[model samples]
Target: MTTDSKRKGIRLPRPLAIFVWAYMVWNLLPVVAAMAFSFNATRSRSQWQGFSTQWWSGTPLSLFDNEEYTAALKHSLELAAMTTVISTVLGTLLALVVTRIRGVAKRPVNFILMIPIVTPELILAVGLYLSLTFITVWPFSVVELGTPAQVVGQVTYTVGFVVVIIRGRIAVLGDGLEAAARDLGAGPIAALVLVLFRLLMPAVLVGAMISFAFSIDNFVITQYLSSDSSTVSIPMYLYTNARGGNTTPALNALATVLVVTTLLAVALASLLYRWATRRESVASDVTGTVALSA
Candidate 1:
């Protein structure tokens, strides 16, 4: 054992530590290389040139200056935003309903909810694509393939994720707080809004972030549902160019932007969740102390 381990009486097996480090390096090296290439002075992805912002903003071919790339980025952000909102709201409500309503139907409802989670994305994409294109069901049929279709497809998949997060949080928090609120003279609606919703804010934020990340990174559904160049998302655009063997460092720049955006979102959510939980804990402790003193 190392001196620290001998002193503290704690040791991670050296072999396990080595394996974990190897796994992290193996997984992250390619991503780091890609991000580094975003700043490359040349178009070569394999060879590193001196750092430059040409691909990001300095030149006309840059992500900010290029019309197609800019449009694709905008489309991705807009779609992610719309999907996040819709999925978070709908998923939260569905989770609440599923958790509160107890009976034989619960298992079936849960199974139905999880179908999208376990089903293959390609299958879901094809199904949605066909339904949108061929099925004429009045108002629903009026929705065309493009950003609207992309948003719908993303929300369909991401709602299940949001449901899972919020439901898990609900399971942890339990129904005790809501019951207490009701016993203290709050109506059901008031209890839900003032007590349950507050407790669920962290999970709601996490679910929204997951929805946003998934919507932004999604490829198959967006590709299948997209109508034309105008509807192309960042992933679709990247795939087309990369497959064409004419991809520039601009693609790397775009990918870096996506990675950084997602990282920032997750970091923010984690901070908020910590803050919320800490505040709730403090409040609970204070309440308990007050009751004890009384």
Candidate 2:
């Protein structure tokens, strides 16, 4: 008779396999396709004529040379960078208060935060337009509701997501460490700064990065709120070109870049998380070993 210890285990659970398959087909496959087509030379979409890098440098980017593409790219980069910083700061603050405080403001702040993330972008866009348009009656105080408006609007949407992310991490953040720091002749603020803030730094970085990605791709609010061509973001530019029946090889090129950048950031975030957890695990193991040795 065969020993039970020698028997092979069953394959992975069916549900996990199915989920992996579904996700690969629906989300991963299309991205892979676009990436592949970035190098494909075809006048028409979906028909791979040949492989070429013409799409990338095929057209020289210049102000007179339709640098709208270049301009949009730069604009988006700036916006994303700004949005990331502001949202991270605001979100972390919001998360800290909401999680640590107890009052009417906690629920209200959370509710308001959820509204931006959960509500449809289209509805938010239209609502913003109405609010901005109508609120401006006086010449001096009447703020010009435009690209600057869109920047603020995008921030409104993105900061909420950042809040949710930071809050999730904050919930799991143990106060025991901070308490001990305080016990060790440290002030409350000092304990929090040295212990709590340092501990949550990874979450803060990841949240800001995630918010940056989202803000980079936001189109609906940007389109509705942006008044002129000065602040046209890459997403808005792509939407216009695609919808207006203007097909270009560069579209695939740009898409490929976006996909790669997104994947890279996601990979980086995953790596950071793994590294952080691994460090914690190693420290725990060392502590356990020393205790056992003692």
Report how far off residue 162 is in candidate 1 (Å): 0.8
Q: What's each prediction's TM-score?
A: 0.90, 0.83
For model 1, residues 120-212, the per-residue Cα lDDT tens digits are 999999999989999999756987999889988999999999999999999999999999999999999999999999889999998988888
Which candidate has the highest TM-score of all? 1
How does residue 107 of candidate 2 score in lDDT?
75
lDDT assessment of candidate 2: 0.74
Local distance difference test, each candidate: 0.89, 0.74
- Residue pair clashes in candidate 1: none
lDDT of 2 by residue, 98-192 (tens): 78767777777678779988899899988878888776565313545665676678788988877777777767766678879988999988987
Residue 80 error, candidate 1, Å: 0.2
